[model samples]
Target: MHSSPRSRRIDEHTIRSLPKAEVHVHLEGTFSLLDILTLAKDNGVRLPGPAATLFDITTHDAFTAPAVTSGGGAGAGAAGLSGFLRFLDWQCGLVRTPAQAARVAYAFAARQSASGVRYSDVIVNPTHWNAWHGRELALMDALASGFDEAEQDGLCAVSIAYSLLRSQSAADAEAVVTDLITRRPHRVVALSVDGDEKVTGRTGEKFRAAFARAAQGGLHRTVHAGESSGPEGVWDAVELLQAERIDHGVRAVEDPALLDRLVGGGISLGVCPRSNVTLGISPSWHEHPLRRLHEAGVLVTLNTDDPAPLGTTLEADWAVAAEQFGFDHADLVGFAARSIDASFADPDTKASLHTELASVAASAVDATTTA
Candidate 1:
């Protein structure tokens, strides 16, 4: 069943012009080497290694391990979870000031816009930012400043998903929920979990109270599951966390019942095809479960989980889904519609995006006919 790369090629122009929404991208993973270099110098933080060394795609290889967070266990070794944490720790160290945060946020917005992403639910795990240790609100405000500026300029509209890492204590998760509910930053939309699911295992039981608090406080919930573990991880997310959406729920393919539950519940899976392959969750795009999941009535949306660090873009991710899975323009539009429907953006924003997506699809069809 292996297909040649060229055999599945999608129309790059059509996909690029198709407006889409992304719901599973991380803010920290969007830092490019240039952004990292600038922030390191500005903050007086030593570079972990040279930019060339860190950003070299060939050096990392495609980690073929299932559900391993990009740095958690797949990076150059110290091997295992600690090494990945160290890698993420070093990256988060660079942005020492609010200005640096804004810079990175702006860059992320610009990059996403280039790939036709009109809206994004960007996950920002405060636990990752060692520099912002006691100043979480300040950090959120700074990132908001950047994203707001981007929005004003008609780039991608963005909302933040404040994440709680599974490695943290349940008390810590509760604390984050309290702060999020109290502060209720204008751009903050959802409560999410971002961490090495494999290392922490199914942790929904531990953070169940916190997620409950978030739900009561009117925050939407999503969790990273079924990436490093199995369908059990996803089941715990839905049953314990009451997750409305799942990040990387690709492994649900292994469980027929789980797949049924996801479809029945209408929980969307933000499948990052390239990120899954690069992180070794799936062997390659050709073999990815996205197509199968879509065919099975599971709502699937394409995205770049951490494009800068992973050397991918939303455009490339869409292309891979089309080329490898044989999704045509109409199918891509369906994916876009699903992403919009699943997003936590304001109702007005979602409505507008839905209309925009329809118009874009119709225009593409009309142009094709004219040609």
Candidate 2:
């Protein structure tokens, strides 16, 4: 063991795989190639592929045929796109029933366990399930069952959130919050506003309503802002939505005053750098806003918004931030702590996890020093 801070970090693996607490993974976005294929088959929904040629649901281009999806046959999606949107549509369809929701949740939880995620706040759109079951209560029941089952399997625990669509009208968005809160407040820990980042802002009244309901229901509020639009969107998400944390809030770096507000307000940022880069909202890893925000005393945490679609995971996402943002070990380790600090878990859980993280870091340092 080197017994020196400089030597410890340098000799360490370039990619640090510490125990992670993932707060931003969407259920729809967590579908593995096998999971999606299984769901598609079970739902009688035909996807574009054989097992080897599959794309995740959150794709930018249109669906390419199975052969074209893997770049085998004459690429159908060379310019325009075909069976891709079907997969996207079918992802929701597969979870229409309660049993299916439990299965997906369990599978997602199992995947997280393998990634060393000790705790996860998995985001799911109840509106998608609600629309199918004809009521919000049914969707909540299904999610509750899924979370309960995941708990039993040592995936630790899961807290659920209902995501409001940006494309929805103001009244419609309010209905989602109102219905979910009314039906199952305990099971639902947060309310998220997502979809187009362009849609995250400009809907001030809708945010206002959602925030009011979130506060009243004792649920935290968050929004997907700043990645697609400007820092102004971050402002709206924090102010209008009463966001405890802003998702993908890299654009806040462009506005110093907004950055000050974020620091002063004690709001956390749920940043997903790879997702931003892959979605074309960001230029590259080195350009991410996380390092500047962290240095400025703002509360920022790392996350993987869609892991598999971008062919990465929480570890890879953290490594990208570390490598490009010039973050050393403390910064990377702090990234994990920040997520734990911003979590919806109880004080006891937070305290215990914090100690666990510190212990893990200490062990790594000790091993290096003694070796």
The digit string of per-residue lDDT tens for model 2 on 1-371 reads: 11222222221243345665778777766777777777777777766444564663324333434321110000112222123323444456676677877787788778777666777877775544433645556666676787788788666577776777665677877777677767665467888876654423466566687678777978878777787688888888877888887877888989999989999988888878777766656666666666677778888888887665556777666655655666667666676787888877778888887888888888867887999
Cα-lDDT of candidate 2: 0.67
List the pairs of residues colliding in candidate 1: 8-323, 64-280, 65-280, 67-227, 67-228, 71-84
Residue 304 local lDDT, model 1: 79
Residues 1-371, candidate 1: write the lDDT tens digits. Answer: 23333336666666778787889898877878888788777877765455687755333333223343333222222232344455566677777888888888899899889888889999988777888988887899999999999999999999999888778889988999999899898798899987778667779899999999999999999999999889999999999999999999999999999999999999999888877776677887778888789889998888777677667788777877777777777878888899888888889999998899999899889988999
Which regions in candidate 1 have their CA more than 4 angstroms from the true location? Answer: 1-8, 57-84
**What TM-score does structure 2 among the candidates reach?**
0.85
State each model's CA lDDT, in order: 0.81, 0.67
TM-scores of all predicted structures: 0.91, 0.85
Model 1 lDDT, residue 113, Cα = 90
Alpha-carbon shift of residue 172 in model 1 (angstroms): 1.0
